[model samples]
Target chain A: MAEPTPELIQRAQRGDPESLGALIVGQQQYIYSIAMSVLRQPEDAADLTQEACMKLLRVIGQYNGESRFTTWLYRLVVNLGRDELRRRGRRVPEMPPMSDDDGEVIDPLQSLADDDRWADPAAVATNTELQGEIRQALDSLEDHYRLALTLYYFEDLRYNDIAEILDVPLNTVKSYIRRGKERLATILASSESEKIQPPRTVAKSDVPVSQPRLARFAWALGRR
Target chain B: MEHCKEYRTNLALRPDGDTAELSQHAATCPECAKAAKRAAAFDTVVQSAVMPMVPDDLTARLLALVPGLAQPMVRSKRWLRQRRAFFAISALLSVIGVAVLIYGLYILGSYVGVSEIWHTQ
Candidate 1:
């Protein structure tokens, strides 16, 4: 497919209906997958995807094409995800005032570090108990780290491209990956208790590699 | 040996060349090797997460979004144009306001000047 050219961008920026329509067509699945990956709710993902696209149309001129168009779109989807998380936080029951002069309760999820908390980090990691902890850990990660790790490992972006998209230095991008991975490893370790076996290694070098089911579910979710 | 260490770190994160050193490391240095193995497993898991058969309606749905996307863009352009026009009209009014204020001040100053001259006479 042709890259989103200057002309296409100009037309879209001007509100050319066809251009706007084409832009949405080109990016809908990507935006939806991004929302699904972060939010883990199909209905919410679909809603965010549409909302992100509409926002993109309204502010298309803000796109300077300095980075790939998709990167900016990813940023939009991520912001929406963050907003959704904050909204959910409000809906969650807060501990009622213990006393008349009671202070605000701190978010327990925010206080704990990533590892030693949740065992599995993948959103679809099957164990329900582990999944809850993992989601909390994921939500706690600073936005850039979460965005970078998701786009890199989950979305399969290279470290360099992520740097470009996030407008951070390459080393910074690496730091986010390393930190995110380490945090995930920690969470998995604490939750699983069993020394998590790497996907079963084949001693016989010739055996085909086995894929983990949780990973498969995540991948399917992304494509959907 | 130096290259091997660097290679091991990368492989520990995502397996690299020569499973032999990594395997040996796993056998002896349990932590390093286990990490390497886990990294490999994680890569497979993430890769699995990344690739899925493209969905059935994704192509059509995406195409459908384009028109929806364009409608607002057009509306926004018109909105922007209106905004600019409003600003321009306001600017013209502002200039007219300043001119009127200056004219009134000049008339008042002339009356004061004439009265002073008559008082001196």
Candidate 2:
């Protein structure tokens, strides 16, 4: 992969299309994965990746190169994804618990189960079970936790890089990762073990509480 | 309190703290040991979930969408932004210039005693 060199950055910053293309091609997957992990939707992830690239181009001059290009990109993409998710008024959706006899729901242990391995071909092919489990657990995680885990683990970034990307302190990033892991574990475990637990009622009243004006605008956009 | 505080600090610094003293203490202290084990398990689970190996085409797709490169809309929008900033600065300067002109005229008139003459008239 071609590194984001000073010349390429300069040309891209100057609005050179070729340089921009090279940069985008280089980082598209990284940006897209982050978006997908956060949005949990392929289409939404694609849109955000495109949007982040565009935004990056527009603000390239503002980048002082104080951090790695990838770190800056991570921050940009995650922030956009979070904003997009919030604008859509989509909180973590709850997963249905597994059921036992008598139709009683059980709380499944929601950590990364022994079955959820990225390397296993069988696991990858018939990933419905694992995917569903991950989706459920991830959806239950707070936005910050989701971002931290996605950036740190999925992106294979270091703690300091994640801290830079999330614009948080190093300790804060660690805390987020730790807490996020605990939450995922609890959610996954609870989902697996208590799969028969009854579904909770989701509220329908939509007076738009606590969402910012921009979020309200995005929510309206998301409706379309 | 001191022992508990030291343990908590050690736990926070390195989740996998393997110090002999910490290990012995954890074995003796059920709470610390449980917390340590939980932390270790949590670490393993997170390591597995990240799935760092990205798809091969990810980089290509990313580069394809880069602004001012692949997307015409981005180029257009960037041009529009530059145009907007230019116009905004121009308008601001125009306003400042008008304000300065008014102030200059008022000061010149005052220096020439025009205000006194106007007051008499």
Highest lDDT model number: 2
Residue-by-residue lDDT tens digits, candidate 2, A1-224: 32378888888878888887777777776777688677866677777877887788778889888887778878888778778877999764222221112221111212333423433333343545655576667766776777777776543467778778777777677666556565776777667656556444333354346754544455335431
Question: What is the DockQ score of candidate 1, to 2 decimals?
Answer: 0.07
Tens-place lDDT digits, model 2, residues B6-101: 564454335333577766787788756555554444444444444334455445556665544444333468899999999999999999999999
Query: Model 1 off-target regions past 4 Å?
Result: A1-19, A86-145, A154-161, A164-169, A189-224, B11-40, B50-65, B68-121
Q: Could you give candidate 1's per-residue lDDT for residues A96-207 as a string of tens digits?
A: 2122113322111221233332222343244445444555555554555455565665444556566665567666665555555556555545555434544443233333
TM-score of chain B of each: 0.34, 0.38
Clashes of each: 10, 32
lDDT of 1 by residue, B41-108 (tens): 44444433432233554545445555543232224688999999999999999999999999987898
Candidate 1, B-chain TM? 0.34
- When summed lDDT is taken over every stretch of 10 residues in candidate 1 chain B, the lowest stretch is B45-54
The TM-scores, one per candidate, come to: 0.46, 0.50
Docking class of 2: incorrect
List the candidate 2 regions with Cα displacement exceeding 4 Å.
Answer: A1-11, A14-18, A85-128, A154-156, A195-224, B1-121
